[model samples]
Target chain A: MTAPQDNPQPKLGIIAGGGALPARLASAAQTAGRAVFVIKLDGHADDPALDEYPNVSTRLGAAAKILDAMRANECRDVVLAGKVARPSFSAIRPDWRAAKLFMKVGMKALGDDGLLRLVGEELEREGFRLVGAHDILTDLAVSEGVLGAIAPDDQAISDARRGLSVARILGQADVGQGCVVQQGLVLALEAIEGTDEMVRRSAKYRREGVGGVLVKASKPQQDKRLDLPAIGLTTIEEAHLAGLRGIALLAGGTMIIDRAAVIARADALGIFVLGLGDEDGETNHGV
Target chain B: MTAPQDNPQPKLGIIAGGGALPARLASAAQTAGRAVFVIKLDGHADDPALDEYPNVSTRLGAAAKILDAMRANECRDVVLAGKVARPSFSAIRPDWRAAKLFMKVGMKALGDDGLLRLVGEELEREGFRLVGAHDILTDLAVSEGVLGAIAPDDQAISDARRGLSVARILGQADVGQGCVVQQGLVLALEAIEGTDEMVRRSAKYRREGVGGVLVKASKPQQDKRLDLPAIGLTTIEEAHLAGLRGIALLAGGTMIIDRAAVIARADALGIFVLGLGDEDGETNHGV
Candidate 1:
């Protein structure tokens, strides 16, 4: 491995999961004048924009190959972005190296948090320091305070605070990152079906008043560099579909995949965005 | 509120949900010399052996009348037990009193957790002191240690530890209590579908020597005086259906309704029962 020259813009290696975040992160990294390396995940990470990266790559579920490529290409920092669903557990065909590692663990190790911890641990063993997605892409780190045009009323704000607390608690449990709460009630909590599905469950609850709050946060012990909670246009679209009025997030911690685009979508949907701060903030209480 | 007199054998009011717990608790309390005023939750509470508690009286969903009977009978300690589900959000006719209270909150505030919290808060406001179902029936709490004739194999133990950690984290988040882990992979997390359904999902990924660990815990912030995480014959039956080997529960903290009967069933099914300490325990290295 070469002792690479220090480039002002560090290249970002995106170990992508399915959905729009990988493409969004890639674009964001490019805008920051850094080379983007896309080691797209199997079945989940065949993004069309991979070709646009300075060094696009592919590997079919082999941890060794994944580490090799990152090290060989001098990619010092990496982020695990987007969804890697639990149902994919049965579908995964681990390669020789992946199988050896797999044999060391059991089915319970396949949950997002377990697998993520294992992945991050495996990387650290190879001498790579994992960094938060926001460390490399600051613009994507969701800003504190509102982003969209609509200012939620006091009732909506209260609901958002409540929802945010429940949602953050869910993340800490490693159960999920999103929950829809309105007027001190929880309409839905994201589980295996994920955020979009949880939001949809709220529709059947007969929304009244300012609707529910959609809160997302990083899991208490998550490997931040690999996965930061992200929201893009689709999230806003789904929130609107679920009859939600506001979104609250852990400020400066979670990532907004495409800030301008997500803000624009939120604006179009007339949703409020609040960067929930840890201190002096209207706290969302957990269970 | 009148200063309650010290009555060692005070009559107890039990809001019986579905399961054998109420019936068992009734017997235990009788043995302890206390009369049981039971409000059997329709469709959920078990059909007890009527011969067992001939004089034990019950009510349907009329919370007001039940409270009246308890007060008249001097039953100062009210214990909510069993698993009558939170009234359905879509099609519940909350009797006049529940309706009047429910009217103050929007539909978004009626998820199970929200509704339970509201009910407990309301009950506290109305002068009833909520104690645990096992308050006078501590004999019914699962023994703190490895139970059953069989112990979980090494792999199962690892998953159980992971399941315990995740379950507690979820508890802290105020999410549901149950989780399934197999071979270190998280197979299913209990959500709105609840515990039995989660076990069924884990069954899908079942393999020999891949026995999953199922853990159910009370959320860290939960008020244990009410809404304790409870299990019964149904849980043991579900473990068999899901091919689980180890069942981890928070030692001393969680309540097992009908503890003796539940253990009998679990023993028959060869499921390992573990009352885990507050901290997650280590696993055997290998089978």
Candidate 2:
């Protein structure tokens, strides 16, 4: 196995999925003075903005072709960003390399994180260093403290803590990463349908006077490089739609994509966007 | 306190909520040759069918009036049936008896089961015996077998087991009692929004070739006399609409309101409705 080069300008590969995160990662890599090579996942990466980068489009199961493209561009470091819907087993038409890896991992029943770790190991075995998008775009990682003018009140803070605790439990089961808690009661839990829909469904359960809080956190045993928990402008919009008082994300464990836009939107909606620290003991409003 | 007499015909009281279950329970109790009295919860019981029985309408927090009405008719055995939405704290205008009980139980922070237990204790103190709705309506209890011709395939059974396990975990937390699982992945967990909406949302997460299963079970520590898990014709309809292959419910623990209608609907939709036994070991697809 080869170690990643200590060269100041190592070539970076971006495996782009749907959403703005991939393009942001590409832009960040370019700004960091590194050569960028992008492999846009067919049917997932339809962003016309990605055309600005040097890229090739390929299907998800064509692992050999993806590796070949990366190697052809002399790329050593790789980052996977954005949303990739889990395809059913029948939908996977894996190439020889991917098929072998799938069989080795007992792909028939592996959860999301399990498949991700297997993919990471396969990438490392092919001599590519797996890096988190946060490595190149550090600003995307949420920082501790309130991100907007409004701060969560005592009730909202309590609900956020309850929500984060439930999320951890769900994460431990390898099920989900987000939930909405209102007045210390869990109103909704995110599963395969994703966060936006969960937020939308929470509207029916919202308390008469008390608003809920949305909590998104990384899984306890997740591969950070593959799929860190993320929230963006859509999250703020949805939270507002759900009549939630705030959004609480795990600090240093979640990605806040389009940070500036998120904060501005949260401020306009009078919603607090808080980045909770590791300790769940006390909530310092930090007004 | 008066011990309930084992007399030939002790009058039964039915605290009715929304839906056909209350009316069905009233009919069943009447058929059993017991005099029936009903206290319909104001907002929840809109069924005109309940008018067939001698009944009085009262608000949720008017416990004194409910008890008075029951005792006025010499009713001793009581059954709470159907759906009652959680009222906000400020909306609860409890009478003296309910106020005392609420203070004794710290009702403001209690979960659904906790509050139900406290209410049961209060009723017992007033010489009323709280009985499960199933006790009077034995036929409403789901039997251990598939209710329709179609059976859950191996994948669907596996998902049902997975969903039931997750639902148990959520139940232990006093959170939810239902979940949708497809191809070994949990699609959604029922929380405050109720079962029908959860089933609707699961439709968005259904896999390409494999449909999911809805699992409803009793919370491990819940009171059997209060809020037992229930399903009705609406469940079968929603499960079909969600593209679910089947429904798995805990036998003897779940109420199947309008059983004949439910079974007919499941058969017409080609959906399996299996009553899972206490042991989650094997799925007996008794067609």
Candidate 3:
């Protein structure tokens, strides 16, 4: 690591969860010449790389302590990254701040996005600027066009479009953010079971000749600062295992974690990885 | 078995698929003093009890043979029962009539319900009245209110309501007909993998204290004569295995195969079996 700068940029505070994205984001921020402080959410964030940075391991529901820790480290910019399974309300032992926020939002009534927005708003109220991991790590945001050696064939493209349409419908319902479409029929829709399980289930319905496409997109009313749709090498591997022809994600709206590795895996598997633009209206007919 | 009647209400032709519903329907029809002729769809209809009735085993896509066989038995009313896997268009070796029907419907563009309706219409054109199994077996139609000994707890009732709402949205989308919801979060949505698989998958997402409810309903635009959702004893067993608290069916719109046995199984498993009415608007709110 380079010697500490005489005057560093505002420290980026990461409320890390499971998976490699949080650590990857920290590295990206550090490389961008910004000091970082990480607060790993206990039982969720388990990356050892976080130890290399100034960090504190804290349990979920300790929102007040988290705010205090970030304040102590002089972190004015906070980014929430990685997966955090929604715990049962009874399991939560929230601090005063979190409790107040929960009371205001009516914890039981809030959906995934609702809870995220409430957290973001609460953080903002304390003078912290909520930042998406993509804001600091721009390379992780999927760009326009296909990203792997294999381009989606006509059938895959059609399936991708169908998948996107279904996903949009699902998002509008605030149900889920991903789906698999095959031969113009929806094979599976991601719910609380998550994407990998959805892909696995879709495999059972795979046809002999036609392959499906997995589409992931941010919810229509989602708060981009928190819980943006994301995929990594594991997603590519899962798609391959599910006998899918390709994976399509909303361009600039989804995070492509470990972009190079994900692309490499897709290329090796001969599965296409295409970043779909929002303007691409539904034209495919079958599904 | 009773001797063949002189003029048996124009033998009810049963287009059978997998499951006990076909056999049950045959028994019900016979008990109602109507001779039954079973045209078992190959690979799907495997019930051994079919041997007890006058039956002809035939492949799907052999629409001409099916029509001829039903006519040979002097059948005027037909009931399509159980499940038929959607065959690939290339794999379908449809006779002249089915081919013409497929061409007119644009087989590639039609959804599950669309194809079913076309088939029903074509059978009507052939002077055969397509009948739902429930019409012959009145006991198979789920009655309003709880069927099993146990009643759904407040939470299960809420989850059932939520599941029904989601199922309706999925139905409107022309997707699958069932879903599992627990504590207000959708655990799984039935797609091509079917209800059993969906229930199995939902088991993975089950929380420590709360169980889910599986809701199965008919599609909004579904051809009631062709594909009404049906649950059987196996469904009750699956729900119990999946740790679900109850099973909910759309009253009057769904078929309850082997009603007594299903209720007995559910009661033994200590799970509620409730038939939901469409008019029961969302009132319970503690899923």
Candidate 4:
């Protein structure tokens, strides 16, 4: 856990999945004067820009190759990034290394968070340091305050608070990351369906007056390095189309991809983008 | 509260909204030699069969007219039935009597169960006894057993148990009546969008395996006299389309409309229809 400044920083091993965040993280690491090596997930990490880094395309089940590649490149600090839907057990032809890991974790590996935690433990046991995506890309972490010009109205705030409580419960069960609430009623709850589809499904249930609010937060017992809640331009566009009033994210625990563009879109659409402070103490924003 | 056989039963007052339940109840009462008067909510109760009985079509907000019509028809026992989407306050133009009732209930009338309880109290104050739809249509109340030729496999039973726990938590908050779960993972939860949409939404999240299960239960502290959870042919068809294995309802608390036809359709589709017993001791049959 020593800071990079305290010793010669090891090459960052970026195990990339799908989405822009991986590429962004690689660029950030390189800009910080740390060499980067990426093991792009074969079918998932489709970003062409990832080719610029000293990288190798590998299957998620090819754990032996992934670990060897990281070792060969002297990459001790690894950061797993982007979206990867859990591959069905039938679909994954795990190598001996992955099969051994699966056998160790057993049925507990089926859950999203549980699998990630086990995988993190495996990586740590193999002598690799796991860094959170937020740690390297600090600017992407949402801060407390309304990001855009518009702030949530009283009704939207109430809806967001309700959504937060629901989302927290769902997360505690390792179910979902977000929910939509409107006019003191829960319009929809996200489960296996991703946030985009959940927002779209909620449009049909929209009541009159101030529209619903989409709220996302980290699981109370979440491992920050695995999957911190995230939002981007697509989320903003979808929220607008769904007739939602705004979006709320857990401050310091949620990642905002392309914050500038997202804020611009939110401002143009008159959608409030709020960053809720920690749940325990009530200091920062009005949220 | 006296049994109909114990005394000369008063004329039944039917506060009909929308759907077949109202008409079915009217015919059942007529067969039992009880006079019935239907106060159909205008714009909602479109059933033409109601015209065969002593009835009046009145606006929901016209409380004076509705009560007067029932009293003039010598109706004392009342049954509220069928689907009625809560009309927004702006959409409902309440008469003075209705307005006074709303004032008395105040903001508590905003929720579905709360509003029903308040209205039921007002009706009782007017000297009318509120009877449950299930009490009159005893055959419709689900019994603890598996209906249809098909029975749920181990996987679907596990999914139903998972859905039941989630649904109960949601019900405690007065949030929803049902949820869909697959392979121990919650797929979708019903809220304001209703069970039909929740099933349709869950279809996209279907995993490769023995499909999901839809579980419905009355709220743990639900007023059964108001809205008891009910399923019909549409539920069967929707579950089939959603790639779901079966449907489970809380035995005794849930109503099955057109039970014979529902069972026949379920058998034809090879979908299991299960009646879950009270959540206490071991059930009569495997859940």
Q: Which candidate ranks first by TM-score, i.e. highest?
A: 3
User: Model 1, residue A41: what's the lDDT?
Assistant: 74
Kindly list the per-residue Cα lDDT of model 2 for residues A39-103, writing each as its tens digit: 99987887788899899999888999999999999999999887887766666578888888888
Query: Is 2 or 3 the stronger prediction by lDDT?
Result: 3
Residue B268 displacement (Å), model 2:
3.3
Judged by TM-score relative to the true structure, which candidate is superior, 2 or 3?
Answer: 3
lDDT of 4 by residue, A1-287 (tens): 22356556689999998889999999988787788999999778988999989899888888899999999999999998987776656556789999999898674375445667777889999999999999898888999988899988877776677677667655655667788877666777777677888899888867776588998888777778876879999999999999998998888768899889999999999999998876722222111
Write the candidate numbers in order of decreasing TM-score: 3, 2, 4, 1
In candidate 3, residue A215 scores what lDDT? 92
Best by lDDT: 3
Per-residue lDDT, model 4, residue A205, is 69
Model 3 per-residue lDDT tens digits across residues A53-85: 999998878988999999999999999998887
Each prediction's total of clashing residue pairs, residues at least 3 apart in sequence or on different chains, is 24, 0, 2, 0
lDDT of 4 by residue, B1-287 (tens): 22356556788999988888899999888877778899998878878898888898887888899889988998989998887776666556789998999898664375545566677888999998999988788888998878778998877776676677667656765667888877666778787777898899888777775588999988877778886888999999999999898998888778999999999999999899988776721222111
DockQ of candidate 2 compared with the true complex: 0.31
C-alpha TM-scores of all predictions: 0.75, 0.88, 0.90, 0.88
Clashing pairs in 2: none
The DockQ figures for the candidates are 0.25, 0.31, 0.32, 0.32
Instruction: Please report, as a residue range, the 10-residue window in candidate 2 chain B with the lowest summed lDDT.
Output: B278-287
